[model samples]
Target: MKNLLVTQYQDFVRWLTRRLGSSDLAQDALQETFLRLEQGSSIGPVHNPKAYLLRIALNMASNRRAADNRRLATSEVDKLLDLPDDAPDPARAVEAKSEISALKRALAELPARRREIFLASWIENLPHPEIARRYQISIRTVQIELKLALEYCDSRLNRRNKLRG
Candidate 1:
């Protein structure tokens, strides 16, 4: 049974990594999933091991995507956008810079988990089941977090617009 599981595990991980778009992340999630399975964590059964592992892989990918988004969003602004020294229009450049700054500030204000859900869903194009699995939470929770985060971001941006007016 153990050897069977191990062999199945490799095939599952390969399918999952291909689906999720990152070999390193797929391997990490595969390791964790097998560890859980070995400990008898009960993620269901092996009849559909591919489907089961894919679900687990999705969750792991969502978590990593969230973390990477946060890191990118918080890093130095100048480093985020690489523009050539030649400025076609100085005024447009300044406005673009200001908009980027505003976006960064808004992203920073959001709670980490909320931010992660929003980015993973919207920017990374991850499905909700994968996100829920990654966070070990329910799909409902993922939906709620994303909705609230978007509302919060919208409100904040509206307020900024009013202040500018």
Candidate 2:
């Protein structure tokens, strides 16, 4: 099984890419299929190895497509854009700006390390592992710093909100 996959990997990827319309998704499916084959239990005699591998890859692609479809439709964003504008009123806009300024101040008050970690994780959408690797700290430390930073900012914002109320 492994030998067949290795020999025909490119062909499989190309076939899947054409069917799936995404080379990246094709690569992912093939990689997953290979991993599964490695850990797969003993297989009985196969009549056609290439057919078997293609079936597995196709099944994986189908499953991935179904899972992705369940998450969100590609047209959802377009539908949102077609919606009527619901612009904020002057008072609401002013209030929102004030809240944003307060949040900025709260963020600025955080320790440099904590602030950087928070921004990297949320604003930059970085994975915790990458952030930890960059900071030369454990993932756990990254999580802790993020948690503390969030708590501090939330408290500051909540306090400000209460004052306005």
Candidate 3:
């Protein structure tokens, strides 16, 4: 195998350069093929050693191409590192907190039973039928209570936004 490889090394590089479009890569692939052959890989009798050697070199080129494809280039890595973070900054964080406080105040102003039903459905993620069963009320009554609570909260938030803007 080594004798055959040495004899056809130039032919393989030329063939690979045409296939891979890079003589440098063809040389590199041939180097790896030489190293792998030196590793004493078991081989039985082969009628066509040249073809077998070409197949191994081509496979090495394919594997190197695949590995290169999966890696990020240096420019790509630098660009990604330079991108601005998505986390909210200090001013936006404070504004979000203020809005949440306003929402809590609005929810606090609801009548006791309506508040409980609203919290159960919205915060606890309880379905309407479960809320009705828990509160011993009809589904219609639960729907009405939730609607009124939502309207009251929406109005309060809208008014707050108007004042702020």
Clashes within 3 Å, all models in order: 1, 0, 0
The TM-score values for the models, in the order shown, are 0.38, 0.45, 0.71
Instruction: Give the number of the best model, judged by TM-score.
Output: 3
Given candidate 2, what's the lDDT at residue 13? 90
Q: Can you tell me which runs of candidate 3 are displaced by over 4 Å?
A: 1-3, 18-24, 38-48, 73-84, 155-165
Name the regions of candidate 2 deviating beyond 4 angstroms: 1-84, 159-165
TM-score winner, 2 or 3 = 3
The alpha-carbon lDDT assigned to residue 73 of candidate 1 equals 57
* Candidate-wise lDDT, in order: 0.74, 0.88, 0.89
Error (Å) of candidate 2 at residue 152 is: 0.4
State which candidate, 2 or 3, has the greater lDDT.
3
Per-residue C-alpha lDDT of model 2 across residues 1-165, encoded as one tens digit per residue: 889999989998998889889999998888878988989788899999999988888888889888988875668978978999689989999999998998899999999999999999989999999999999999999999987887788798886334223
What is the clash tally of candidate 2?
Answer: 0
Candidate 3 to truth, TM: 0.71
Using lDDT as the measure, the top candidate is 3
Q: What lDDT does candidate 3 reach at residue 37? A: 91
Per-residue lDDT tens digits for candidate 3, residues 1-165, read 887788888998999899889999898888888989999978888899888887888889999999999999999999999999999999999998998898899999999999999999989999999999999999999999988888888798875334223
Better candidate number, 1 or 3, judged by TM-score: 3
